[model samples]
Target: MSWYVYILKCSDNTYYTGVTKDLKRRVDEHNGDDKKAAKYTKSRRPVRLFWSEPHESRSSACQREAAIKRMKRTEKVALASRV
Candidate 1:
């Protein structure tokens, strides 16, 4: 199965990074009010998908997510623009 590292632009203009096996379902979870919604994203509701990159394995996707999370906001924005 394909894994993905995704970036979301929150309603407050902040960004969130995560990994998921199903991008659509994950995004839905982030946007929904359900228990699955991340606390960070739940408050920053109505987030839009800014970028996503595919990976062959979950480990790779998680690694990418960690790298993106460590990046400065400007760096993340630049990366997102290239996607």
Candidate 2:
């Protein structure tokens, strides 16, 4: 199965990083249009996908997402720019 590291830019201008096996469905959930929506994201309303990276394993995807989360806002912006 394909795992992915995804980033969402919340309506509040905050970014959320997560790992998921289904990128499209995950994004949809974050959008608060479904029952599976994350509580934190549901209140944030509209969220735009800022970046994504595919990984071969869930562990790798989670690690990558965590690494990205540790980055400074500028670095995150740069990373998003590169993507």
Best by lDDT: 1
All candidates: TM-score: 0.95, 0.89
Report how far off residue 23 is in candidate 1 (Å).
Answer: 0.6
Which portions of model 2 miss their true places by more than 4 Å?
Answer: none
Which residue pairs in model 2 clash with each other? none
Please write out the lDDT profile of model 1 over residues 5-28, one tens digit for every residue: 999999999999999999899999
Candidate 2 per-residue lDDT, tens place, 1-83, comes to: 88999889999998888889988888987885667887778888799888998899988988898899899989988998995
lDDT of model 2, residue 60: 93
TM-score of 2: 0.89
Error of 1 at 15 (Å): 0.5
Worst 10 residues of 2 by lDDT: 31-40
